[model samples]
Target: MILLCPPGVYKAQSDTHLLAGRVAQLAHGRHVLDLGTGTGALALTGARAGAQSVTAVDLSRRCVATTRLNFLLHRRPVRVHRGDLYEPVRGRRFGLIVANPPYVPSETSVLPRHTRGRSWDAGPTGRAILDRICDGAPEHLEDDGTLLLVHSAVCGPERTLERLAAAGLSAEVVDRARIPFGPVMRSRAQLLERSGLIEPGEHLEELVVVEARRG
Candidate 1:
């Protein structure tokens, strides 16, 4: 689908497409929530796939506006909100929750405010956002619902599984894709190598989709 992404809104990328396939398969007949909605691509996919309802949340005002506009342009039904992870939807639950949150390890913990880096920078261990999702997603899922998260293996998918499991959900790697470094990873290759996050000169990183549900 063609989306209007403003200057600061994240453009849908590999992770988005990866999670989208799962959305198409699992979103029908469910009330779906797309966290870190970016261009609302995943939420739109859910709506298109016949979801009972679709709500999207993003931390960026630009992203919220872009997504809302995109949905309007497509004449699809969606509720778009601007807020941090799970904040806007407090006390709400859904049948499916999907996120492709920021997971690229960055040098600092302070997230970028004015750049596109906000879309992927997740601080030193890249768990800043991932951990939050792991902790909060389970609480927001219906008893039979599922949470789907896509991120780089560099961020430690095993840890995600452990966290989700500890939170009372059964979690596992559902999908993986090894793609050449994008501009962000390419720029941080040397740093990642020095930090032992990746093998020296490793040009490809594996992306993983983690699926979680009530244990």
Candidate 2:
């Protein structure tokens, strides 16, 4: 089974990705949940950081298999589930919910060149997944639990903060970085045009890490 499994079926070792190594440092010693846990990057990092338990979920079966393999490889106690955001984790709450969902503004193509799945697409406005995650997060987090997300600056941290407020969460900035533009930006622009999210010709110049906590 191991030999026949596709490359996508096993979690990969990536060093330069945004969330891989940074998660442990940020999520230290928390009861964490990793939404969209592709390749188990954040999940593994949480385990390494001394989380009580790491519950990671992904919509892709392949991603679930890969995450399972990664957990075993590290001998960490992680629960890998296959389902969309919050579905697999219904009735459960965490002290820290971390997600690196596809944040490319809608109309742009996700990276990796070959990905053509929900894991890579963020809908027409690129806020589809992020919106849903934020809307549902309050119910899945403890009063002091935090929701950590990495997304594009194009998506407008201001808008994200509004969404969090609508859901009764207080939003804050934890980190920021500038990534070179990609096809995702084109998609984001197109989505903004169609959805009236922004005037035509506006540009997004950076990415941001947003942290929100339930009241």
Candidate 3:
């Protein structure tokens, strides 16, 4: 599929492909929602996987437009919305929801505004958007629905599992990959280590795909 990622919109990366692989497994004939659908990678993946319907949501106008364009370019039918997580899909429910949110830990508690950094910087604990997704997903999911989320271990995968469990969904880490630090992570290695989020001299980060299912 031809995808055009304009400036300020996130280009699909390893984490995106990881989540897309998982989405391909469960999207057949199911209604799928791709939260934080940067570049519409996962959404298109779901559509191609035979999903009954696919809806994508992103907060960035650029991302929303890019996703729509990609869907059109590929001739995939996806409903694209521009809003915060779960906000655009209010009163709706889906059988599967996938998210590759901004999980990189930042030094400040305030999330970035007016910068491309908004695509990767979560707050100080890196739970700003992660926590919101974990909390809000259950309500948007049908009984027996599944939520696929990919994030860095530095943001605490256990916390994600626990939060989803607390919200009445059974959660587990289904897949993980150790990847070398990228520019964003490489630059913040020291700060992450100082914050005890990562071990000193640890240059590798584990990206995990957490699967949460509603009973």
Candidate 4:
């Protein structure tokens, strides 16, 4: 599908494709939600996979515009909203929710306010947005619904599993891939090593897809 990613909008990358592949497997005829839907990559993937309906949420206006443009260009109908995480979809639920959130560990405790960094920096420990997604997803999911999330192992996949389980969902690491560190991770490799989040001289991080189901 044709997508126009203007300045400040995140371009689809490996993590996006990883989540898109999983979404394609399960989105057929299901109501699918795409959180942090940058470039509308995963949302378009779901629509192409025969999802009955697709709704996408993003905090960036540029991203929202870019996704809407992609949906129109591809002749795929997707409800696009601009808001933080689930804010735009309050009181709604879906059969499938997919996310490829910002997971690159950052030095600051507070997430970036306004910069390209917002696309990848997730504050110290890299759980700023991931934690929110895990905590709130159960409430937004229909019974027997599934949540598919992709992130770097540097953010602690085990913690995500525990949080999802604690939220009353059965969660597991469904997929994993080792990829070389991108610009963001490479820039902070030293800090990550000092924090013991990664081994010294490590140039790669494991990307994991955590699948959580609400029974």
TM-score of 2: 0.79
- Lowest lDDT 10-residue stretch of candidate 1: 111-120
Which candidate, 2 or 3, has the higher TM-score?
A: 3
Q: In candidate 3, what are the lDDT values of residues 59-118, reduced to their tens digit?
A: 888898999999989998989999988998899999999999999999887887668999
Counting clashing residue pairs in each candidate, in order, gives 0, 5, 0, 0
lDDT of 2 by residue, 1-215 (tens): 01223555323322115554456665776779999887787788788888887999987787888788778877788988988889998999998898888765544444332354455466555787888998999999987888888877656788889999999999987777765445545555666667776567766446677888876
Q: Cα lDDT of all candidates, in order?
A: 0.93, 0.73, 0.92, 0.92
Compose the digit string of candidate 4's lDDT tens values, residues 78-121.
Answer: 99999999999999999999999999888897887578989999
Q: Tell me, what's the RMSD of every candidate?
A: 0.8, 5.0, 0.9, 0.9
lDDT of 2 at 60: 79
For candidate 3, which ten residues in a row score worst on lDDT? 106-115
Q: Is candidate 2 or candidate 4 better by TM-score?
A: 4
lDDT of 1 by residue, 1-215 (tens): 89898788888998899989998999999999999998899999999999999999998888988898999999998998888989999999999999999999999999886688988899999989999998998779999999999999999999999999999999999899999999999999988998899999899989999999997
Query: By lDDT, is 2 or 4 better?
Result: 4
Candidate 1 stretches with Cα past 4 Å from truth are none
lDDT of 3 at 28: 99
The pairs that clash in candidate 2 are 105-188, 106-126, 106-187, 107-187, 108-187
